[model samples]
Target: MREMTIGKNDAGQRLDKFLQKALPSLPPSLMHKYVRLKRIKCNGKRCQTSDRLTEGDVLSLYINDEFFQPVKEEEAFRRITPRLHILYEDDHILLCDKRPGMVVHEDDQGTLDTLINHIKAYLYEKGEWDPDKEQSFTPALCNRIDRYTGGIVMAAKTAEGLRVLNEKIRLHQVQKFYLCLVHGTPSPRQAVIQDTLLKDSKQNQVRVVKKNTPGARTASMSYKVLQSRGKLSLVECELFTGRTHQIRVQLSHRGWPLVGDTKYGTMERNRPYGMTHQALYSYKLHFSQEGDWGELSYLRGKTFQVEDVPFLPFFYNQPKN
Candidate 1:
């Protein structure tokens, strides 16, 4: 028989989970079969798969020694070192300043050019995540920005961190702010706008629709001008609801299309820079919580911000409002 002791990181996890991590080569089918046959035990007593493990617990296995041999993890994936700019990092989460045109998740082409994989690779090098030691608990992103937008995105380093932050986001306790450059000055500069937006998945576009329009969802956001020059205005936007291309579609529908927006913007107006994508940035994030957040409680009442990209220098030089 073979024996192993649980550590802090492995504590509080399920018996099956710890076993999977400890014995990566053991297939789930065989692992369950062994457990059923009393081939696995904790402290010399048969244990259930759902039993939670604790530090110092001595687990023993009567299974064959061959099941202990796991596959070589490093051979599975080559490490990647993308041009990642880190803004804030703690034991629980990592906040990165993502560059423009980088997709957060892969597209239809199955491209791996995503921020999540980049983050994973970074952690792997630091020995934070290892397939040799971990079965399925990989670091994940808590929030995502569009491919063309540049700004702060949160990455959860642990499963507990993911759960806490996602709860805060679900309850609207997490506030996200963006900086966007639009073509015209919106009337009533500061106001929350609500409209129905219908998305065309086939074309990857969304349009503002009438009330009760079928397949349309309600979208709401508040915006105010920070600076303006001639026809271009720098706007600060806060989203109350998230939808596909919500900010881009909503602002464009109001006649103030984004500076570099090719879809809903004008070609004649985009001539100056020969730009292809809209100039939008997710610049800041504010967190507030009253109750338990587990590992993320430290984030409560804190704000993380990133400076405006080439936009501030690029837009500030324009004639002032």
Candidate 2:
């Protein structure tokens, strides 16, 4: 028999769900049978499978030892060399400057060198995270940026931080600003682009459509041309809707495709710039003061920005007015 005490990260989850994560080797049927047989108890009393776990609750498991063995993948983070460009960090959250070409999570290609793994490794080294002590929670990213797009990404060190951050983002209480170099200067210089976006999953691309189709979603963003070079322009965009590739697709539809964007803009057009990946960066983030963020309340009305964008100086050096 073994007893596990619920911590803050492990609380607020159902017993069955927590069991699934804590004892992956335990068969579902057997787990249910154990609960029915009073083999699994909460605080020394019989507990239901659907019972929501609370902090300070103790779970007594009369199961076999084999079910407690950790999986190999749980130790993968320890093998990785932590490479992080952290912008800000607190007890609850961390902000990182992800460089272009680094993936936030593992893709279909089965790459191990990912941003989250590096973060996990960093936390493990600092004694902030221990997989053995955790049942269902791990340090997780609150937001994701494209693999080829450099930007600021937020990570949550605690489960409450993740929940609050996700809620704020869903309510549009968190504002994101992006910087991109486009092929041509926008005629109006500043305007909000509103359109429907349809994503083609097979092609891994999105297109701006005239109307809402079956799978299309409304996309909106306001952009301002900050500087203009010979044939290229530096643009700052603020997203009102978080659609996939909304800025890229909408800007391309407006004849201002991002520089080095081979999918939306011609490769021949990008050849002059010698950039294979799109010149886009999520440079700034702001947390709106209006929302109640619970533990993350201290972050309200705060703005964090990345000062140095790799593509900025090159475009800003151009002589064109």
Task: Tell me the TM-score of each prediction against the true structure.
Answer: 0.80, 0.93
Task: Assess each prediction's global lDDT (C-alpha) against the native.
Answer: 0.83, 0.91
Q: Give the TM-score (vs. native) of candidate 2.
A: 0.93
The 10 consecutive residues of candidate 2 with the worst lDDT sum are 69-78
Task: Name the runs in model 1 displaced over 4 angstroms.
Answer: 1-77
After superposition, which runs of candidate 2 have C-alpha atoms over 4 Å from their true positions? 27-37
Worst ten in a row by lDDT for model 1: 71-80
- Deviation from native of the Cα of residue 71 in model 1, angstroms: 11
Q: Report the Cα lDDT for residue 176, model 2.
A: 96
User: On a 0 to 100 scale, what is the lDDT of residue 56 in model 1?
Assistant: 87
- Could you tell me the C-alpha RMSD of candidate 1 in Å? 3.8
Model 2 vs truth, CA RMSD: 2.0
